[model samples]
Target: MNKPNQETLDELKAIYVQKIKAEFPKQLKNFSDKNAKEHQLSQLRGYLHKLVGSGESFGYTDITHTARAAESIATSLMSESTKDKPSRLTYLVKLLEKLAGIVDKIEIESPVTLHSGANFTDRQSNAKLLTVGQAHIAKTERKHTICVWVIDDDESVAAQLSEQLLSFGFDVAYFLSCAAFKQALLSSQPHFVIADVRLEDNSDFYRCADLHRIDLKSFGLIIMSAFDDFHARIKAVRSGAITYLQKPINVARVASFIHEHKNKIQLHPERILIIDDDTDLSALYKSQLEAAGMAVHNLSDPRKVMAAIQEYQPDLVLIDLYMPDFSGMELAAVIRQFDNFTSLPIVYISSETDNQRQSKAIATGGADEFITKPVSADILITALRTRVKRARQLNALISKDSLTGLLKHSAIKEAVKSEIARTSRDRQSLCISMLDIDRFKRVNDTYGHAVGDTVIESLANLLTQRVRQTDHVGRYGGEEFMLVMPGCDAESAQVILDDIRERFSNIEFTVGNKGFHCTVSAGFVQLEASVFLPTADSLVEHADSALYEAKNTGRNRVVQSITARI
Candidate 1:
């Protein structure tokens, strides 16, 4: 296997370091609380167990052994028998102390940039701005329509904050007070409400029951207070505030907070495959997962686990511990054999809650997690959501371009290969296109690299918006991109690409006071159902030839590959 380029390694490293920073504090707090509640201890043990397994994989050998030992002690303490809890707690503390030292020693060249103004943040913000357009275009582009209700008595603050949020693409609604908000709620409810902690009439915050309405997901509550009293904060939390912000807040930070929470409610529905012989229980689980906006498929046949996984391409899998044909652990081992499914999470669902036995099963079977039966709906949802989110983050770190958020070079190739197989198997029409920015090198030389980057990002954003949702768009490399259009012929593909090319060329870009325009040359190859299908590599080569042809012809047009049997 070839070693990855330095850029890819740097991206992967940066993501791992960020994960450590974000998670280490919570893990340390949990580890230090030897007298924590049982559930807290259980959570700590599970986290440490996962950390132990993943830390080594990411080359954090410094803490892996210590985390592994701590996990063992945690497992012992969490077991039903409590006779050894005192000794295990002492030993776990020692291990944690040592682990802290190890964590301090593990070095990462770069830190995660969470705040604005950082290079990554600036890139993301600028790229998003490229998508800034008319109200309806923004609405169509948004994955979920997030309507934020801001209830504050201060008209000045409310007006300014509303404008800022609207800039961030949120549908904003403002109210003068809680009374107005409640009246509006009676007719329509927003996804999130940001209200002052105190009202002039002292009316109770939102009715908690309204948020618990089963017909819809729970609404978000954010409390804004001018007071710094401990009781005020506590009251806000008790009143169901997901976030509490002080007065004179940075509106941008507030928007970021709300958007972060909004993302929780609007994630792309993760796909999950469940293999359990208990049909009734599986169906119940399936419905619960679906209610959380996950795509779920449940199969009663344990023997078909591999086939089901390949077909569903699920982010996570749930398997019953006891099945008539095979045990969940055995099936998990089989699934791990396939390289494509190696990172897919396999969680075992069983009635047994014994910590020791669960640890052993996890280790022996190479599974990610074990959930005892009779779990609460919230716990199940939270557990699966956390795993899926982490897996996706990891996947993005390795597969996504750092600057543009498009698939990396290698990932795009893999996508092309997969598309070829899919089109061949289904006998569907498909088109592959290559696009290159005209005179990109000249832009970088003329107006610094940052301006050049802005040009690239603008084009990427245009492609993301103009293309159909079903199309696959990736940044093949610098100044070049690949587009795979399934169920489309050369004519339709050309129409779409040509339109994008025109729109992209019309985008007015500026560096200081000087302004300029950019254009793209695109070429496509269509796989006709009646013609002999070409290999992915062959198609890519033909598309490249066509792209150059477009560049040679006039420098800003779409050209079709001359790949017919003629």
Candidate 2:
């Protein structure tokens, strides 16, 4: 997921602080006037609930604890508040003052963010949450095109469907008879099959008996029939067709069906961050995470929290509950001061074995998990897996673009920077590809932004299908995209990107009855660790210059950057 930059995070954090400050006094006055009324007291509890949840996340730990306490007091006094106005008023006023002070503290301590921590289960679920798995994390990868073979008896209908499917970026082949399709199946397996119920020889292609004879489980099957009744649907279902469409298949529906299946084929590995002052413990966690096929980073000094965040950008942060200079809760609070890091999952790892005390710390720290020290490696892995998985799933919603699932600008930049440094240190190969849709404005001007978006989406999907899972792809902004290829050389990267460029250009995009194709230009820089490449920014700049070279040479090509200083 694309992580927001420091400046953007700071701006968002400031905005949130101001909003809370502005709402505090208005709500405080409303509560004060109706202190003795049960309904009004209930309303006051709502405000307290907000403070309890968000206050600590933004580093206002005191407000969170105080609001929690005040909520309990308010709840207890709800029934007797009429006879206890003086006491209710006194307690409520104190809470309001405390809330106001927290706002002041937030504004002054904006830059004093510490480190975000982890997620913890509720106190009752701590034992269950810690039950780990011995199984190591497995590495995931990516694949190729959505090759669909179409079988239908109608010639015009078959041609029309093929044209539309191709326009939507699918590789489609139309065959009039089942015999021909069966022959083609022997040569190459199609990812999908769109077959008609009837054939020229009057054979039932979707008959249950026929389905069992053919290896129907090998591919996604969609059957089309003029008869759109329950009987046809049930027979199609029994015949092993996953999708049953009527005579005239909606081209858009078929495209969406194919696109969703393509997405299901993509996978990304998990990344975890460990924040423990204990070098030994941090190393242990690192070893476990790595064994499970996860990328891990460790930080001993809490002072470099923000720098670590900018560089690491982990899915989950493992925080030690106890630290001498800075407490675990303090670090978690500091990380939360930045709005962007607020949602970051933090799990507390410490030697504190007392269940009540650990639970209290977990609750107060706003952590996602609380694991006792001397815990098994399996338990740690299980806890991190469950919590981090959820965090990443949620992160994608905010970090990825609506059109392409690629990381947005800031996040992708962060990813590229980290990978460049990693590959440089390990003496590995790294390539940065900056690609742009050639004459994108012309597409929008001629067709429309909506169609232009389809072109961009097509290119994004093609790139994902073409690259390895270890690589990163992001919509760097506008028509351009940035691809970070680790363990990939300039020549190999060029070959892969050129393949995507050719495929993207060949995809016949449709606008109503008319169809047009779009092309892409890419410039990538290979930073061979042994060859002494420049800074990350320099690499990107060089790639950009090379991209211009490609555009000048006539778009729809890939160019490798010169090793010499530009």
Candidate 3:
């Protein structure tokens, strides 16, 4: 096999190290069982053989040679001829540990500048000349388009609805018949569907129910019904429609419903921000909501409420009624002024349940609903679902960047911060990294932003593909990304990130007749309970510092912060 370049070699070594660290302990634990021991020996031997073949190619000859020796001993133990089998297993385990230690000492080199790589520079040069609009056009082409199903039998209704939805920047499929809709649903697997309850026949309702049973993972469903009776609406709800809207369908209301529930359909977990001056109340709400699997952000500062909201960009904002100077009503009104938050649902949580006070709270454009204090978990969640769904609908209008399907910069920051807080409180190890496409400005300066945007999106897709399911990767800013790896330590995190770098370097991107590739630089820090227990800022700073070191050292590598000796 051909040898990997120095960069690739380092990355592979990191992966090998992580695999050894994670697998060795479990392998040892199984040693007590005779059958399990033998089975593990076989598995270890196979792994060693592969490692020997690949490790030398990545220039880790010493580690590979040791693994091969370990493999031989384990193989001998399995055959029962080796009298020192227990000792051999012990030796093998120690050798693997030694190999892991060697890998831990290897440092990731900095990424080469975008233009320095043979493929990346070409794309950069071509991205330089395009106008802003033209660049957006190119980016639009590269985005992963989500399909939406609009299932209304009325042609005029469907068309009007489709137009409204498409304006919000979604790819839409319109179906007039339930049969046609079901057929399309199989292939499209839309992110969400807007459907009418009354189909051509009663069988359509059964079909809808059937669809839910079969594709429980399908994006959220919003049903429109002509029935004014409460029982029929209740039936629709029971049948699994997240919400049932009564006709005549108001376009604005339908749009709102779609916006709020769209994310629910896609199963993006709800993010709830609780703003209360009382620490005990905040903790109470936070614990209850987290127990329900909803992400919560708690802020005790009434003065910094806006800043918290902007930072958290929560799906639902729960505020205490009374505060020192800025009351919940006042805060809601202030939030409503921002175009991005115009329809954001702000629910008041207070002791005052009097109709007059409730009416006053509701009068604030930002306050969507009021839940009296000492709110039960059930009522709170119901209010949250209502508000969050509505916020999602409002988000459809303003939150997403049309090109990448990533939350705009403002929203992404809040989401990252919330994730940081959640992971910290849960005591899970988290890896946060900042990724920058090396010399992105040069790419934009050379190829025109059109091609530049393509490269950016391609990188985003690669990051998304490479990370674990629990990880969150978002476009942080222009040409930069913020990634969160939950349940990963520094060593394990580096391995995953290095693999991403290696795979990304090999990807082929094109602009017209021109072909190109790009490399990314990342800096990451692990969240350990003892070090970064309460604050999100420290973790971010650590990662940022590491990223800076990576950029300075060279660009395509992962750097981690070194804690100072006390």
Candidate 4:
């Protein structure tokens, strides 16, 4: 995610070209031999393979293709020639001569110009392979502690909110008045400002808001008020408030709101897996792509492509078409064999220029596109970004709920089953929760289905905001939702779900001019791998039973399954 050192990259390119040129005499001698030894042929094959990868990367297409031809000949000869040896040897020798000529003529551009079209971030860490979930955890670990400043004349309100935020893992400071808050701001700023709309006759708060809008535009401002009037809301909006919360402030809701904002601002770098036998070329691709705000993993051995895919879960795969044992098309087909990866984008980035063969590769339904070698950095970035975005949109359309944008019923069930299998293997705990809006039929009858739908959307957003990136939330159907949390115990699940329950109860929904609140009941079952053999259906059923108990006792609560309570 950092800006790549173009000078370093260009220098590397120059070094590669020079290295090839220096090795030209030995390569020529090997190719000239009618009966080359296996070791000599093997060395020639390795050299040609490097050229096939790096030549195109450095924009030497002629050299890449020449090397490819020579490499093919070397491979055939090493494997015991089945073709006319004299003709093959002549062709191979000519190809090696052509490759040497191309290398001699290769030009290295100094301080290569980098495209600034994409916004790149500072990764701060060394490049490595990690799944999106693992990346999220790493990001969280590196993130600075969020500090929240609560400005309210009401001491009780400020203290209660501050305490709750502290419990929710935020550093909190409360000021009794705007003056005290302003004084603190002069010293240092908090990540968020939760200010009462009326602090000392409301005049001081408005003045403070004006100061914040002008001087501290970066920090998030959450305006809290007892008033639900249009005028008050407009004033808050004008003052650059991110959200206006009605007092009787739900701390969990505020926390969720903050998290939503954070998610929006966070840079989730695109994941890319480059499968190529050439480590040097793969390294170059990794560096260039990472500079353009993508996470890249390089795997030289095609045999480990499956393991890399499962572990790294890349958004797009860039494969060299001519690896030793398995071709890129073969690997692509293997990846497509899995239902989960059928939609994943596979692109062949090689020097292969045969149009008919390229068409055949794509027609096989394995590869999405063929990117010929010598692609400009800008073109490569644009092509990859476009493919990844479209793929995600397509995947979402197939698996996401139309109403809430969470996973659909079957998709969620499948996700649960997969997680259960993983938990069984890892011998970790898994929590499955079922949630339903309280008295949803009454809500629809009173406020109509449109308002009911709005409530459902609101809850969906809340669940998405509160859950971890590793957790899965799905619209189970209608007003019900399902949450799957791997490696979570019942007690932790209860705590999280209870907070969400309390927060949902405090979310005010307006129908016409009347503002009202809604509630939800949640039931979760935690499966201990040592004690229980978990299945998706059994987990859902137990959680549903717990939800029934929660509804029976009282609405607006979270309950752990009696059968699996820890």
Candidate maximizing TM-score = 4
Query: In order, what is each prediction's RMSD in angstroms?
Result: 19.7, 17.1, 25.8, 8.1
Residue pairs in collision within model 4: none
Using TM-score as the measure, name the better of candidate 1 and candidate 3.
Answer: 1
The estimated TM-scores of all candidates read 0.56, 0.52, 0.37, 0.68
Q: After superposition, how far is residue 435 of candidate 1 from its true place, in Å?
A: 1.3
Ranking by TM-score: 4, 1, 2, 3
For candidate 1, the lDDT comes to 0.71
| lDDT scores of the candidates, listed in order | 0.71, 0.71, 0.64, 0.77
The residue pairs that clash in candidate 1, if any, are: none
Better of 2 and 3 by lDDT: 2
lDDT of 4 by residue, 1-566 (tens): 24567654765576566566667777777554766778877877877776776777776778777888888888888787576877877888878777777777866555333222121112223223332234222234313346678988888878877876655555678998766776766656567888887877656587765665435455788898888999889988887889999867755456656755753332456799999886657767777887787879888888988888876879999998877678888889899999889888999987667799899988774799999876767888889988988887788899999877799999999989988877877788899999999999999999899878777877887787567767899999889999999989888898989878887776667665677888899998988886556567888999999999999997788888887733
Query: Number of clashing pairs, model 2?
Result: 17
Candidate 2: regions farther than 4 A off: 1-266, 269-355, 361-366, 370-386, 530-533, 564-566
For each predicted model, how many residue pairs clash, with residues at least 3 apart or on different chains? 0, 17, 25, 0
> Could you tell me the TM-score of candidate 4?
0.68
Across residues 127-186, which tens digit of lDDT does each residue of candidate 2 receive? 322322211111112323467778888889898888766654456789988778766765
